[model samples]
Target: MTGTFKKIRRRVWLILNILVVFWMLAGVLCMQVPPSEFWPAGFVALSLPGALVLNFLFLLYWVFRRSWLLVLPLAALLLGWNYYGRLLAINFAEEVPKEAKTLQVLSFNTHVFNAYDKIVEGVPQVSNDMVDWVATHPADVFCLQEFYSRVNSIEYNNFNRIGTRYGKYKFVSTLETDRIKANLGIVIFSKYPILQGGTIHFLNKQRESANRAAWADLDVNGDTVRIYAVHLQSMSIKSEDIENTYSAIGNEESFKKEGRNVARRLKRGFIARAQQVEQLLEHVRQSPYPAIVCGDFNDIPFSYTYQELAEELENAFVKAGNGVGATYNGPLPFLRIDNQFYSPGLRAVSFETHYEMGLSDHFPISATYVLEPKAAE
Candidate 1:
């Protein structure tokens, strides 16, 4: 009876171990395939980092047990070393060298600048704080997504406030604007002269939303650099969905129903983002100048959206970020969705995630990039 029980336990342990390895590999290799072609890979990607942690724990367990199973986890990690390699940063410099010819770029999603929120029901709301922050803070190029403005109001008129600070050259692409002249869009504000600018239109119509990506060609010290401010297809996780979460918990049927709704939104988001990334990647490849991509990707590093861009650009955080790259500040745990990526001609000297800002659901991120003389004119 003791021997039989030992056999049963061993079988369960082996099966669990194999499942972990399978999931780890799928998340690494399968993510390379477009989510449009196989949507399951997108779900696997969402679980990748967690699976990695589980695999590490499994390895430690095997080592302590003096079992041969340790080989599986070690081999899995080695196989996906490139993806894992990006998780850690060895760079220690937090600021760019004063001697370096640097372009300071800041990207943020302002969450509609909280224009809809009111303070005293009659006066201006907390958005004044964000407006004050932007007016005082300085950056050479500021790429803002979900940028909102009430064209008539003096208090929330960020369109003028931002330009008043530093940027005379600007480009604004509207995703939505209503009768009250309340504008919501993506914008590029540059201290440098904007030679040209335009919105990147994704071919897939299904992905259309208030989220959009825009770019600008700026004359930076006689060099033309393209800055892409992207707010890719939003996950659109609704407030009602969030409210239903607490009610769903502890009720098995309710939980499944709520889970399905959220899952559907995520799946839709994954496929749409993959489409957008493909289009943007082709545009980046054809760019005539060194390009810098910044904003809310709304997908993790393990995702197809990120993988597609990472293939063509150097991720700023992976290059110079100090630790824990998660930029989303909502209910989700450790989601590093906001990012900065640069063309080969440029390298990030320093990068920072502005987690201190609580004005929005997503944290703002900035990076100082220097054009490599040999790679860019």
Candidate 2:
């Protein structure tokens, strides 16, 4: 009887080990594949965090069991070091040099600065708080996504308020929607003079809301730096999806339906973002000056959108940030959809995500960079 029990335990362990290996392989494949509309790779990419955790658990299990299988998860982790680094970093007390010619940039998605809530509740407290925060947090440049402004509204003009807050700064924006009474778009406010700026409109199939990539050529002292502020295709996740995902355990049918809906949205977003990134990359390559890309990518670090962008630029978070560096404030807490990427000509000195501000669904990310004169030329 004891021998039979031991046999059953060994078989169970073997089965679990095989499952871990399969998941690890899937995670590795996700890292290698470029997510496209035709071949959607986000489902595999989404499995990565769980795979990593499972691998770590396996490593510990094998270690305690005194088994040679410990090497399997160890090897898997070593292979995906690049992906791990992007998810977390340990900078070891690195500090920015005081004398360096630095530029501070803040990227945020303000969820229309709570304008909807204000319109519904007859209270503008959240918008007022955000405006006050912007007035105090003195960044050299601000790349804002889901920005809202009104040209003819009787109550408030957020655009003018933000632009006029800093006496030395100039601002530019492009609407992502065609609302005549209000402007819903992305915006860039810079302390430096903007030489030229424009918007790249993306092709939307559903035509619900327009998404765009906006660029500005800023003369930063003696050097020209091109900045691209992009708001990619959103997943279109509704509150119902979140509730369904959480309550999915008991009812299989409802769970499956919600799962399908969520997956469909993710797949669509992944495809749309891929097309948008291709266009944005071409625009970046053609720029004569050093480029700094900042915005809410609406995708994860492990997705194809990030991989394509990372191939051309340095991720500021990986260069200078610490911890998981999550920027999204939602039901899915681990998502880091907001990012800052810079050309080789600039060195990211410090990168941070401000979580204290609760005005929006996205926590603001900021990075300070110094120009490398030789590389700039």
List the global CA lDDT of all models.
Answer: 0.82, 0.80
lDDT of 2 by residue, 180-246 (tens): 4667788888889988898877765545337788899889888889988999988789666888788
Q: How do all models score by TM-score?
A: 0.90, 0.90
- lDDT measured at residue 164 in model 1 versus the true structure, 0 to 100: 56
Lowest lDDT block of 10, candidate 2: 117-126
Q: How do the residues 2-85 of candidate 1 rate in per-residue lDDT, one tens digit apiece?
A: 999977886787788889888887788877988888998899887888778787788888788788878988887777776765
Kindly provide the TM-score of model 2 when superposed on the true structure, using C-alpha atoms. Answer: 0.90
Deviation in Å, model 2, residue 4 alpha carbon: 7.3
Which candidate number maximizes lDDT? 1
In TM-score terms, candidate 1 sits at 0.90
User: What's the CA error at residue 225 for candidate 1, in Å?
Assistant: 1.1
